[model samples]
Target: MELLQLQYFLVVARLEHVTEAARSLHVTQSSLSKTIGRLEEDLGVPLFDRVGRKLRLNEYGNKFLHRAERALFELEQGKQELRDLSSPEQGTLELAVTAASALPHILREFRKKRPHVQFHVQMLATQEMVKLLHQGDVDVCLSSPAVEEEDIECQVVYNDPILVAVPKGHRLAERTSVSLTELKDESFIGVKRGYGTRDLADRICKSVGFEPKYVYEGDEPARLSALVEAEIGIAFIPSTARNSRDQIQYLQVENHELVREIALLWHKRRYISQTALEFREVVADYFKPLT
Candidate 1:
């Protein structure tokens, strides 16, 4: 019923632990419980199902949470709009990306255009980026394996070529291009399963009639090049990731659609300020000539 109650409820629902949520909100556990209880009473239904010390959102809570989140998001947007009115040239743009290879170039371009504007950036997994965008936690997202949600607006920023990376002296290192089928039996170093690059590589490998056998599965895309250089495994490396590393050779994948389309995404319903719009333009322009 109260704004404070709604805020407390949202934290509890997200964490699913009363103690942790209370600690995060810097409130006493008993007080948080009382607030949630009052909210449930006001609504005439329990928002959560209790199982020992843990909590889970019930059907009614699930339905209400979406609306609750939207209400808070809109209110926060209104507050941001007011703040922007006072300081139009300076504001923090919250951004999320799946990879960091192309980020620096885009950010440098953006900063040149809007030196007064600041950025708060997070490198997240593809799925986590989607969740943050939907929750209105981040202003914009640069993602791969682009999202297809109904309320999300996704635009292709660039189609980065994915190549096979091999050690300097490997048999295929002398080649300019190689097919996925040729590397079918070779061990690979790959990004984790949920990653966009990994998904694309897996799909391509499967199309070639085999799944990539990864000897090293890592979270960092930058490290894959080193892993390949050590003869640990070959890997599918994006063109943006080829940051002047001399120990490895990058070969184009022959007769295959070995490209990852990086997309810029944002929620359609979330408010966009001038600062955010400028950054978006900077991003689009950064990739324009390359495409």
Candidate 2:
């Protein structure tokens, strides 16, 4: 009926001698005899046949012995697994990140601190990251803000300044910084709608008092850089989107209020695992200066 009672019954069942079980169990023989009596009384069955001083298991007690042993073993194993999860030795940590946010520093530090954690990471857009988190496809995500939704928690990692990706021979390349108004006359290449880049592009155009005359729209960096090289148009992106060997050059926007905030996103229903929390602390410490 109770685990303690079952445990006492099991010890007596194994030894088949009340005195021997009591000695092994470190209890007085009278206390062990009384405990066995209580177990039998609670179960409404005589577990052992008492012949003189010897104890022998009845059929029901023999049948229940294996099941009781399995229950206790499983309980001990369950506790061990929980302890392993907290030990920082091994685990699967699933996460997603924005297509381009400079998180190499944080990732390097995380790997150094937790080498045993297997990381599953993907490059995704802000909206895509939100979708994955909601569907429970990932434990966490790094993203730029796009679609505002409920039940999704976001923490700002840092702000990345937007830089214009221009053709090397473009006239504005000589300028230290240029306003969005200066780009109204230039053909602007931009990311598609619903993406953070697209929103910022629209905001810049709006501030400069004219919408962009786009010649191309997509989310690929290499191809966009190639397009800029071919003299198609110029585009704006966060600094992380640069390709060092590309013919396109990144330019600063002076007196510009535009900035992209990189954030860590998670579902409200999901509890951050110990490894995830540790990595979060690492990122926070790494990016504190940028915030």
Candidate 3:
């Protein structure tokens, strides 16, 4: 069978859940199921037995697991061993993130140190990152903290204290920060549903005992910033979004210690490559993101 087929087989075996495995792998469940079926046909034996909707590894499957794991381990070891010979800095790091602020310095330093290594970065939602780690589609992810799911292990990379972005002319800009009570009647630009930012925005508003006036909503970070510059409403973004903009200013909320913690996540069961670990160190040092 192909390497991909074996990898998929192992993922399915670990999860014993086709749907979750497929979602994590960033592939359709039907496709993965077919791949496993083809693999079983080639081997003339089934690795899984479906009991209603659940899957269990049969005796034959358990017997094959040791061999399969050995093979996978050897394959990875081969790649790791040959890393030095492949190129100057060798090996590839595939990482995905949800925003732009946390990228620049880390990327520059990574490329500078490992010019031969390659990078693949994707901006994704917090849940998407956790799913990909489970399926092995990506090795690492950074996003907002997800508490409800115990399946995904996450560590805080940076605690992003939520900052208020308002146009300079606004009355609130005179203060260091605003509070939920202070901004109860103030116009607000809302983050759209289904996005990771939306949850934080909603929670902050709810704490004030009032729904925010929705000036606008979208996936674009720039659009929301523009609305704030136009003074249509105030927007809340991570402190990192604070940049040199004359028309716009960032302020802290009064007595509001609300922090939108950005986290680095991975499947606790998986082993991270040395190269990936190096990258994590650089990122951790890059922002030195405030706690």
Query: Cα lDDT of all candidates, in order?
Result: 0.88, 0.76, 0.75
Candidate 1 overall lDDT versus native: 0.88
TM-score of candidate 1 versus the correct structure, residues matched by position: 0.86
Instruction: Kindly give the number of clashing pairs for every candidate.
Output: 0, 0, 3
Write down the worst ten-residue block by lDDT for model 3.
Answer: 80-89
Candidate 2, lDDT over the whole model: 0.76
Candidate 1 residue runs with Cα over 4 Å from true position: 12-21, 33-68
What's the TM-score of each model vs. the native? 0.86, 0.63, 0.71
For model 1, name the residue pairs that clash: none
TM-score of 3: 0.71
The best candidate by lDDT is: 1
| Candidates in order: C-alpha RMSD to true structure | 2.9, 16.5, 5.9
As a whole number from 0 to 100, the lDDT of residue 93 in candidate 1 is 94
Span of 10 residues, lowest total lDDT, candidate 1? 240-249
Deviation in Å, model 3, residue 257 alpha carbon: 2.3
